[model samples]
Target: MKTDDPTMLAAHDWDFPVPIAYGPGRLAEMGRRCIELGIRNPLIVTDRGSRDLPFIGQLQSLLENEGLSATIFSDISPNPVDSEIGLGRKAFRAGGHDAVIAIGGGSAMDGGKAICLTANNDHDLWAFEFEQPVPVIGQGENFPALITIPTTAGTGAETESTAMVTHADKGMKFCVWHPDLKPALALLDPELTVGLPRTLTAWTGADALVHAIEAYLVPGFNPLCDGLALEGLALIAKWLPVAVDEPQNLTARGGMLVGSSLAGIAFLKGLGMVHAISHMVGAEFNTQHGLTNAILLPVVLRFNLPGQEEKVRRMAQAMDLSDTSVEGFIAAVETMLDQTEIPKSLGEIGVPADCAARIADKALKDSAARTNPRVATQAEVQAMIEKAIAHAR
Candidate 1:
């Protein structure tokens, strides 16, 4: 976000983890890309809110003009469930869709991936879950492709190869992973995000920040992911406030958009307690993912990142902190929390105080906790949740 050049951000294509077409107004080229994927008919998977956006209609026209038919499947929820994916699979089959174009936030994208993975197979969805002892035998690789166009700058679902959906019966959010689930292309258009509510802009930006922070601290030897996380943390720290305040600033929007995707890419190295706890909290409270993350991050940082002096120093530098210590980075998070108007406590946002044990039990079961630098016991996690619930930050 700081540069001596003082130049405009330009549109460009990148192929780090996938084919990414990033810029403002790149939605105009969606039709050409569909053709290249041999998609004569595509299913547009999005949430009800995004389905009502004007660009949805324009996107249909864009595809239609290119000799491709696009159908809408917008029966998605904020946190996708197995039933929603079932409906999407049915819609995909009924429409005779050749590929999928998921264009919205994380839920829509995850739903799209689940639909794509199960459209041609009758395998039980849970059988393919990453945590299953035995993997499901079948998949739908024969499908043409999946293209993700994110309207929000969080979750990085565009770059993820897993779909996190709630189990209706279990009442918990769980993820399914398969290499085939990764999107063939991700289109990032800052213009599409300009209309996002200011609060959502702030929350989602904080979500990206948490992603980079957690991934950076995940005990790992992947220097590639480490570098990406550090750089992404820097970008989000520099640009999130601008995006939140000046919703129309294309440069700030672009910065958060790319920073979010980079964080998403980095988290492929794996997340930590932040996601582990957030996934469960979201299932129980139906809270926004980013809001929960933003509220929980300050607390989680103290619990997870205290003694890693070297990593802490590097993170401080990445965030441009003058003090270059853990507390300095935390003060920065607290400042952003105020700027974003995030609640001081999870209880303020409606997470009940009495449910810490249940939430912590489930959070421990979540795969994300496996990579947290400081391993947590159930009591430790519950205590952390209690403090979070009580406005400990």
Candidate 2:
């Protein structure tokens, strides 16, 4: 296969920057990876809910057996805020840890990434935000060596170089992007996801779908990322329901795990309105990330329909929907949401109509909002929020 041949384009530009090992029980090798990375003392950053799980206990024991003392920082919350990052940073520094082992969902992984950055940087995390022509964080600076183990099959935080941390006082999500934030290694072990609740499985799986769909429809369609986005979409369409309905289905879990990682890689090209709108809804309402994406997905698809009709038609075919029309594609997504038992509206998740404008304004300013197929004006964004609010009602 010629490297530049169109047939090989996907494989050529598709770069898996971090080493990712995928399989059942692959997490058991995390300690070995840590050793290879020269980590003597590693801090496992995770949420409190995951600490009691047998898988997490097993990881801890594995580290202990390797003569590496692993400290647990399970104080992170669902929408991890700056305070959580600060606390995690303090814990990391005090423990004299050499590396970070992020374990769990997006929140835990993001928290771990933030702590790693703060541990090595002199400036505060928020100071690294990109503004206008100035780039956030200098180039080529190395943070702590980081390893990631995702317990959920969504968020793909393990593969990305960005972290979304909620503001301390504003109650809005802010992202910190830097090459240094990417994990040194990622382990995708489906066994760690077997204990995920049906609701969580559906929510996170939907998030993965949104990532792939939005990345595919976003303005810049890099051939490499488009292939990944489409493949990820197909996997989620086929496996998410099975994983949600049958918690013990390792095959479904494995597919979702791989799909999530692919979606993360796809988003490197760009993401669309679904993420921009969902981020606002999530931060303002404290809704689950995947659930928020699922709720706003069809609405964003409809809003971008005029420009993305062909893409939606192709997506409809990929999802195996009978209808190829834009509306048909939207309906298919809605159907998937219904099958997964995801909420249909923002109101269902406690987002008030009065707060819609504020969320819309913030969304318009988000970096993800810039890459949307149709660049949303403030009025257009506000209208989308109203539509979302009405849909929820």
Best by lDDT: 1
lDDT of 2 by residue, 121-162 (tens): 566778756432323454544577888889999898787657
Question: Candidate 2, which segments miss by more than 4 Å at Cα?
Answer: 1-15, 130-141
Query: lDDT per residue, candidate 1, 215-299, as tens digits?
Result: 9999969999999999998888888898888888888888889889999999888899989999999988889999999999888
Superposed on all Cα atoms, the candidates' RMSDs to the truth, in angstroms, are: 1.8, 5.2
Candidate 1 pairs with clashing backbones: none
The weakest ten consecutive residues by lDDT in model 2 span 1-10
lDDT of 1 at 248: 86
Whole-model lDDT values for every prediction: 0.86, 0.81
Candidate 1: count the clashes: 0
> In candidate 1, residue 148 scores what lDDT?
93
Off by over 4 Å in 1: 1-8, 133-141
